[model samples]
Target: MNFKNNKILSALLLLTLTYTTGCYKDKSNDGLTPINTVQITDPLTAGTVTVFQGDVLRLKPTLTLSMTEKMDKLEFSWLVYNSNGQISLASPRAVISNQYELNYLIQGEPFILGEPYIVRLAVKDTETGVISYINYKVSIGNKYGTGWLVLEDKAGNGDLSFIFPDSTVEHQIYSSRNTAPLVGPKKLELTPFVITDGISDVGKRLYILAETGSQEYNYLTMVKKFDYGFEFYIAPTIQKPTVMTWLSTTSGSTRSANIGIVINNGKAHSNLVGGFPGTKKWGDIALTPQGTTNYSLAPYAVGGPGVAAMIYDNTSKRFYNIIAFSNTPGAGSLTAFPAIANTPGQFDLNNVGKTMIFQDSSDVVHTYNSVMKGDDNLPYLYRYKTANTSTATPNLSISNIQMNAPGILNYTAAASSTNTGHIYYSNANVISRYEVGSNSIVETYTFPAGENVTAIKYAKYNFNDKEAVKRARLVVGTWNGTEGKLYYFALSQTGSIGSYTKQFTGFGKIVDLAYKY
Candidate 1:
């Protein structure tokens, strides 16, 4: 073969292959489609938004789609971005909702309280396979995060005043949020951890008991969640609620057990809730050891972390030890206290004959104090030192003394602090401090004319120890016939009030106060 001819043919073959494969073509597509993107005319402001836990979050936004886009062809979804501000791949993103209008309860979400998370709304047009997103930073809060609840009587109607941690007051919050009025306000108590909803986690609750009716509200919102009668299988015939209190005992840092005692028309009802097989209703009236005797209980009870409650039967005029916390409904009963001999400074718990006027317990001293009135028309102070109820029989000790202090008989509102030796009582406009150790009045203060002390409470906030100064405060409520005022005084070590630290007014006949956490 001729070498030059063969080489020329090889070069021509290489040139032909390059022109057909490597050279790019410049041609417009004949039948290709452009993306149909939807536009949102209004979006949730693209910043941090706050929502309260357990509240309904409803968000609706009007959208302006492209001319070619149709509402039926759009798909929507909501998802939370991971910590890196992107959709997570290690874990599947759960779809919060798949609707244009979002309505959901802020519960059971992995997001933590007071922490911000990036939530994204995705809108897709299937025709163009394109998605648009709206992102918002959301944080969860509690409406009743931390405050003091003041239950008042406004012209014979029940009202509530909330005091924020910053000392801002919200008046008539209960009446504003609820349509059904709370009438004849009597007592307000916060229950220990309870299962408000059988599905949610354990939480505290607020009970507002009154002469007209009693009801339970969400501690976080003050919204009526359940009527007090709902807590009873068979509602009481006479729904006269005087008092309700929590019972619990602690050993070291562990709360061993807890229950609630409710006094309605002098009958006692007890229940243990917030756990498996939790019976979330009041049982039948508590029965005494004596068969068939309908003994009425005093309207006051004393129990705390280190002490079990002691109930006083005014019919028998004696004290009894409460049975252990039980899950069986209607099994609450009272047992007779072991009889002890009367001593110089102590009295027998089984045979004492006195009507309990006011009683409370202190976790610091593990002691319960009571101011009782005798049949002879005299007042006495009784102290009971209780041991932790970890054993079968707890060792109980008691001390009794007749209150001979000045203004003791004229006591209108009275309160004593934990481990403090002073008992503060009010006689109309005058507030007198009596020393329990010396059985004498130590200090006294008289308010301006026309102001009568209505309620006096000693705040013992166990949740926030940072509020140490506040825990030592003595909250005094006064009414000048029209408007009520709350005065918070920082009590000294000796229980003397020089002046008030804070005063919130504009309430109506403050009858009761409780700290909410």
Candidate 2:
């Protein structure tokens, strides 16, 4: 009666308690309470929605349930994890809402691109205490990337900086923009606007041409992230790279022509960088030279696309057709042209109108008696239109034109984007415009009285659009040894000087202003 009765009583009590409360949860309202299941009904599914850091994420998600009334008892929470799937405490969570702002680089954590984060939304049912989760992988892209990349040369030392539209300038960004510091201490030149395999926003590349190290002549040679100057695009190792240009990379395009480029370092040593397909790396262009001799180039325009360039040998002192020197794929070479006669012994050459517009020894004149006095050396321009290499021999008939009076000041000139007929030339403290067929200046812009004009280069190629109606901005450099500045200007729709636009200052001296497109 003691052992058997006690054991039987214990078993009967255990069965009765188990029936009263299923497992440990009370089942008194089991028949009255509802049974249901919930699922995320928006944002498609996992890996469906994509977002970038510091962007607005709108999630107006609804719930699909076995029964609809349970929606009222649902509670939602948001959670974000780092690329490593570690819960990022910095990522804040909010109640289910239509808009949620995401910030991956919050406070202590700075932006680390290519680091993917997973965002999960947890929705729980208060009645059942059941939870459902929907996940999304957020990737950082180059959306917040646009600006001007300025190249500076302190004495012989070279560095890079970035100036965004918001006026925030990142100085010496080369050190951080790439995995390695931009070739430094002796930056020879900056070649911006090299196209890359990546998309345009972040994929565009810039070459920080460095001075040859340990006596190597190849300048900086570090390919950089155009958006952030310091970021290196790839391993920095190139041979005597001079300049680059970009044309259509895809094969068999129906467009009118390819914007091919020709690069030359002195005796026309060549290196090209452009695309042949959408996935190719952004480096040396694809060139099938006519022969080994054709591998190099003569003097070619830096960003001149589909434009003819005159090849005047520094050693020969004689002007030759560019074709007589280098041959670029999809680009015609210079055809033979009559040798120039009685040309100035000294000249400055800037490719204007896709031809040679030279500033002679401030002396040569048109009249026969002009030589008796001496070279006027005024703002006179001698333009020679080199023929299309695929068509005919270049003509030597010169268009002897005059601009403002030229002095001993450093003068630099570049063609306008409006039309080849328009040109810009910078003097001591002035920027003057001239029309090819006109004998007088079309317009002139004088800098702040004493600011000296340092260099002139064409910028903002395809400024607003990349179509037939291309726009260009002229970047003029000026400095007083310690502080340097650049003045931006736009050409009128009709090729006239439009206005004095933006001014960027803060530098030792601007060695160059290559457009980062």
Candidate 3:
């Protein structure tokens, strides 16, 4: 019990007392479990992410901790710092949890294309007084330009012209019928022209056939650029001159423009010494050595009244024709004939007595048979017969492939020998294509919901590995209140139709399209 003994006993007694009462309970790490740190899983980096103008961006956090951990008092605060560096937390608050996702739409004012923005997310533990924060940079842009010029119309005396990516403008060819006025001023007038192989011949001359006022006006129009400036011509009373080809025939005594080898009313007829009387009888004008004129029918004559002709066959040595008409007995009645005869070979005597002349590539004539009738009371196909025979037969024929939907307004068909024959047409809101040979209708494309399509064209363009002469493309023009827009669809090689990677918007209403390559 001396001084040294007393000090040692005091230290021993202190240790014994600490052990018995468990002083280590207050020293162990056990209070609020240190809040197992919060983190944002998405937007892991501090750089920019891009999204469309009206789309949404999601923000999420990755949490890792025991479920027994207290999370009821956790709170989240989202703050957005715009491009101008103004901070605002006007958005609603969220609770932090292990299995929750938060989405934020980066929308407010109209987002300027190609601009950068910043967003921030913060999580706090109210119980422990701890906070965590994260930030991200984002950008917005519109990559697609406008679309192609599908349909073109002229108003207020403006001469319509179209330029390609190279900035070369090709003036539309105006024909004589287009020059004449059918209705008085203030008529909602329009002239439609087709550009053959426009993609290949981007800046070259284009062939166009447009009606001046109505079928009564009947202008077979052709416009092209020769050595001089642009030149145009018009003939009267021709039906839709869908396709044109150049041919050679013996020069005859006809005063009609000397383009030889003319076919009319499904019959091949050369011009007599003088041109067919009146402008009404003039068929499609073919490019001739002298100039562009109606095809010549030497000995035979155009039989029916409506002289509508479309190209049927083309070869290096000769060409064939298909003429659509009505056989009903009347002044404007039409009678279709399918016959085969050698062209520019026989005139005067050899060709004089022949009627309904149509020939195929093998120089064989196809007899026209009464097959079908259209809504206009015209026989879609008349019985096929040889030049002098009247036996109904069917050797080579054309069939009408009906469209899928019925609301088609302004419809047109263009074909390329490269692929199966396909037709494209447009209604008020959508664009479509059909495979004629396969008899399959495909609603291959659609524009923005409320767009109105004016015209559609299919031309041959080279892309990928194949020489695509029959690639289906569409040029659509639409208006959103103030400005007109144009869109182009570059269909896939397999002829799958949709929007192309390229587009051109913000232009006037396109009235016509013509291309020469």
> What TM-score does structure 2 among the candidates reach?
0.51
Q: How many Å off is the CA of 470 in candidate 3?
A: 11
TM-score of 3: 0.35
| Highest lDDT model number | 1
Question: Model 1, residue 196: what's the lDDT?
Answer: 40
Error of 3 at 358 (Å): 20
How well does candidate 3 score on lDDT at residue 140? 70
lDDT of candidate 2 over 202-297, digit per residue (tens): 333344444432111111222332422112234224434343333331222232212323343433322222324443322232232232223333
TM-score of each: 0.77, 0.51, 0.35
lDDT of 3 by residue, 257-365 (tens): 2222233323232222132333222233333322333333322221211123323211111223323322422112112234434333222211121222221111122
What RMSD does model 3 have? Answer: 22.5
> lDDT of each structure?
0.74, 0.45, 0.37
Q: Write the per-residue lDDT of candidate 1 for residues 212-264, one digit (tens) a residue.
A: 76888876767787787887868887899887766666544445336667888
For residue 319, model 1's alpha carbon misses the true position, in angstroms, by 0.7
Which sections of candidate 2 miss by over 4 Å? 1-118, 121-139, 143-145, 165-170, 178-205, 212-241, 246-265, 271-299, 302-311, 318-409, 412-417, 459-472, 490-499
